[model samples]
Target: MIGETLSEDVLSQLKTILPKYGLEDTELKIIQSYRDSSQLNQQSGFSFQNEAGSKIQEEKIHLLENELRILKDKDHLAQSVAKEINVLFPSVDSFSLGDFLVQNVQDFSSSKEVTVLVKWKHQVGSVERKRLELF
Candidate 1:
């Protein structure tokens, strides 16, 4: 959830999304202003029914539109990323690397086992063997 303070990157992304969705810079500014105003109103316990508050409320609608647009873009991006990962390592029924590796009987009985053991030793160093008396 976008808390009281949104990041600069999020605002910049909004700027890019606004134009793509036919929104102007001024429109985005107005939307951001409303967001700020609403935060202030929440703190003050005031009804957003005054003239200025009405404008802010209207801008809130635009902000929701912008949020929805961004979410849709993100959803599409997630799908595309999934497809790319699938294509890169196809022939696996599922996406999990751990599950796939464990299920597949790719020969790891000799050289692969040695390679893994060496890599693990390199990672842990001699300290584990010395401490655990794993001679």
Candidate 2:
């Protein structure tokens, strides 16, 4: 059952059980939201004709809009990071890029320089690590 507040005990139980089903926190949140919204819709059937129901509908719309904005911002950020990574390693193919893992980021605020530690696996099964600087 969904409650007004998601308790620590519920979260702990979810954390333990979800992994066995190959579901992560984000996926669980989406599923929970969908189920909650479905329940709300059922409970409010035809009630939208009233003022109170209209206010609740407006609030839900606002909440959904905010979530959409956050998702868009995250998408833009991911694209920007991918562009930076491509610029940092032009020779690295798309498939090889998958093998690259970011180890650390060092930023020099005064100089406007950023250093990233990247570890990559080569086609020959050897691992290579590099420190790249961007200005």
Candidate 3:
């Protein structure tokens, strides 16, 4: 049956005899593989449903991964900006990031450009200074 050719007679005989070969007699020795195949078919149906469910969930995972990457990139940019400011004013004692804002505007190139505006605050001694940085 596997890669080997079968004669029509063998095929017909197999179809005819397979079901009747093991009748439940006084001895309970019946073909177990036949019942196993039936159970496997039922289980395959259940797994098919799960497979379809996983397809939808896979898209959800993709979207969440993209959102996570964008957040990480934004955070990295913010950290770099803060580090630069810290280097410029080493005496600055405290730094707090307040809000992140995005805007669309035209630059010197006369094309639409996306601008990321970060609102932050730093304290020197008791004086707190707030500023907005853009990139």
Q: Pick the candidate with the highest TM-score.
A: 3
lDDT of 1 at 50: 81
Q: Which ten residues in a row have the lowest lDDT in candidate 3?
A: 126-135
C-alpha lDDT (0 to 100) for residue 47 of candidate 2: 30
For model 2 the local lDDT of residue 1 reads 44
TM-score per model over all chains: 0.30, 0.35, 0.38
RMSD, each candidate, Å? Answer: 22.8, 20.3, 13.5
Where is model 2 poorest over a 10-residue stretch in terms of lDDT? 126-135
lDDT of each: 0.52, 0.54, 0.53
RMSD of 2: 20.3
Candidate 3, clashing residue pairs?
none
Tell me which of candidates 1 and 2 scores higher on TM-score: 2
Q: Write the per-residue lDDT of candidate 2 for residues 1-135, one digit (tens) a residue.
A: 445566678877877798688775545541244355556557545232578888999999999999899767766765777687677655444421121333444653233232333443334222222333322
Q: What is the lDDT of residue 26 in candidate 3?
A: 28
Clashing pairs in 1: none
Q: Which stretches of candidate 1 lie over 4 Å from their true place?
A: 1-50, 91-135
Candidate 1 TM-score versus the reference: 0.30
